[model samples]
Target chain A: MSDKPKILILDDEEDLLATYKDLLTNLPSKPEIYTTTNGARAVAMLDAEQFSLLITDLHMPEIDGFQVLAIVRRRFPELKILAISSVLEEQYRARAYSLGVDMCWQKPGTENEIKMFFDCIESLLEERPSEGFRGIQNKSLVDLIQLECICRNSTTLKVISGGIEGKIYILDGEIIDAEFGNLTGDIAFKKLISLKKGSFEYLPAVTERERKIFSSTDGLLLDAAQTIDETTAEDKSEVPDASETGDRTALVKPVIAMSKIDGVDFILIGELKSPQPSDSWGVDDSKNLHKWISNTVQLWRSFGDKFLCGELKDIFLYGHHCKVVLKTKENKLLCAGFKATVNNETIPNLMKDVIALWV
Target chain B: MGLTKAKKDQSIKLIITKPGSFTVDANGNILSSTLPLSVPDKFIEIIIHNVLETFLTARASGLIFEEVIIQFIGLKIVAREMRGGALIHLTPLKP
Candidate 1:
């Protein structure tokens, strides 16, 4: 955040932009002022330079104010946004707030309305909230692109996270091109926007950045979300699909989440009645594994009772093939099979961490 | 894990690990018993078979059971491989 307030005015009309610039100079704060008639230029300026306040016109050419607001709102958390529109519709105002706009107003027409507009700006520039901000700050990159395309932004964006960098071009509210590493078109867009975390910077659109992606922004987002969800579900290793395990989902969730981490090869919930595992992670369709777990429990329970071990809690089986931790709860046996590569000393703590949440 | 000679010497107090015990053969047949079990030999044999048979079956499937520790609310059973049989011990769990 800048020490002194910096305000940027974005309007399609150069005359209105000039008037706002001249009027804001009267404020006692003497904040730096920037004006741009091009919405793309305004977004690039906001990204390149840190500005404390952004005053944008909702109805603009090339790119509208709502797109600019969505783009900058998350990228710059501390910055305040004020939206002005010629056709002050109720839905547009609502849309602006949803996009993280702090305040929205009709463009000044009457002298009294003009005076009030200037007064609101002066107060907004001067006042700082002691409490935290209200609007949602964690919008996904896919959402940002959707908003950009919705407003028909003819701009380019460079998305980056960790070692991966991708470029997406939205021409008139449609994804025309995308490039990530060697991948291109819709595949590149899906892979790029599907990234879990990243920062996006505005870029000037190239005239010849070929139309690689034919799908609309909405289609692309849906495709990307679906693609990513399937990959995540597979990575989680739920044999029966955790989403479909309606009744046992609550207990199955934590186990599903912990799969493949800490060398846990497979996790299983063995219902004494079911021949197969009720819910499993990283486990194949094997009935013998489930039977082995049930038999192991029965044997351990009998030993614990006969030898005065009392109410059976859990059993740890260490072997040459693999290590197994079995926890008996009611009629269900919560089981985890470990990879041989995992150190034996750390298996107990790791098992507890994996099953601790619900079991 | 085993204690070193230094640790053994530092641990001067006597520790009674076995409160009661029994032994089972590789086929899960009761070999001997020291702690008079309330359950009959048939129930004991049934349990031993249920557990060790499964253990052997798992071993055949490339998952051999070297040692198994069964924890309970008030006691613990640590079974270690002895020859082809199992050496089972019972001890009260310290709160």
Candidate 2:
């Protein structure tokens, strides 16, 4: 009913909320301004009241800014949407446009951009149309997170918060790397990844060239990080016994390698012994032993599919009455017998020696 | 007592005579035996452990062990002819 247009601003930052409120309050028409620190609360307000313009920041706890846009487009089609962020990247901008964002404003060096955004909003409010594609918002930190998640992308996400820059690498939705200005990798990830409840500011406008470089380098890092995260998560979730955990972790590499083996891969361990004349009770005994060996080989071959390569031609197993051997397509040779065993005490120790060869 | 003991002594004695060595390739192929006469027990254990460990670690590290093998040696030794040995094969798990 008031002559002034009503505007709602949503962001998780209290300071930004106040700043925007102060900015809007000083305007000529004295627009009615409403602010909240979360997208969910903002939606609640929207459900209760009608507003001429809606401004939102992308990153926030619980519901994110994009989800807010999606909701507005679906439920409140008539509302003019303006997206604001400090970290504006290309992919995010593209997404914002697809979601029907009217104006995208980058926070830094963009005071005038905000003013122009309002001007466009005023013009659009005067003549509402059926449907039109609005300008895309700049890429926000939230946008980057979403993009990474959707692509199952792995990389270090650097965010400038307060006066410090924080970096976190997400691999397969698991946080594997994090650094708050100084620390990085495992230590950082351990410290910060769990602090999901805190609020932080981020700069959104990274250069295009820098973004491209980041995507390439961070991509590989992210993939590795994801693998670690997944393993760690599995370890934690399953709460496997220490020995089992050790066994499982050890298998990770071999499984991946076995999957990658071109045709067939074989591994053998233990000493082989022939049946003594006194031990050979009858011919049926040898046949039984062969059957057992065959069964074990079949079981081992079944696991080959779980490896990274997933295709194996054949595996030839040979061993004394108590020995075992496996052969693959790449090369044929005996590995890790008496000399290696005497050198190491435990199975893990011997395995470590074996793995060292590949590394 | 003498008659019972003598009768019990008539049972046949079982002796293992197989001779082999434990061997493992880098491809995670594990072969272990206790029948071969030439392979050593320590080498066989190492081979078995290495093969299983290779599989486990590979799963953990996201890498692969191409092949592994282990052979066992079984032979009777009166005084000293029991020098045991094992052969190891290792390669990358390449696609």
DockQ of all candidate complexes? 0.27, 0.02
lDDT by residue (A1-359, candidate 1, tens digit) is 22467898989997888788888877777777777776765665665455778999999877778788877775665677899998989999999988767789999899999889878887888876322223323667766787788788888988765446789887877789999999998788878866665456789977687797787677778888898788678767756543477554453355555652568766777687578877665554346778878877776666555544455778888887678888887788888889777877898889778777545
Per-residue CA lDDT of candidate 2, range A1-359, in tens? 24577788999888978987987776666777777776765765665456778988876778888999987766665577888778989888888877767777666456677787656656655554332212212333343555676776655565432224476666654344456757765555433433222223333322221221134334644554565577568768776564655654453433233312222122232212312211111122332333333343444333332222233333322222111223222222222222221212243343344444333
Give the 10-residue window scoring lowest on summed lDDT in candidate 2 chain A. Answer: A274-283
In angstroms, give how far residue A247 of model 1 lies from its true place: 20
Q: Assess candidate 2 and give its lDDT.
A: 0.47
| Weakest lDDT window of 10 consecutive positions for candidate 1 chain B | B8-17
Off by over 4 Å in 2: A108-111, A114-359, B1-95
Q: What is the interface RMSD of candidate 1, in Å?
A: 8.9
lDDT by residue (B18-72, candidate 1, tens digit) is 3666888876777787766454565446546655665677776657878887777
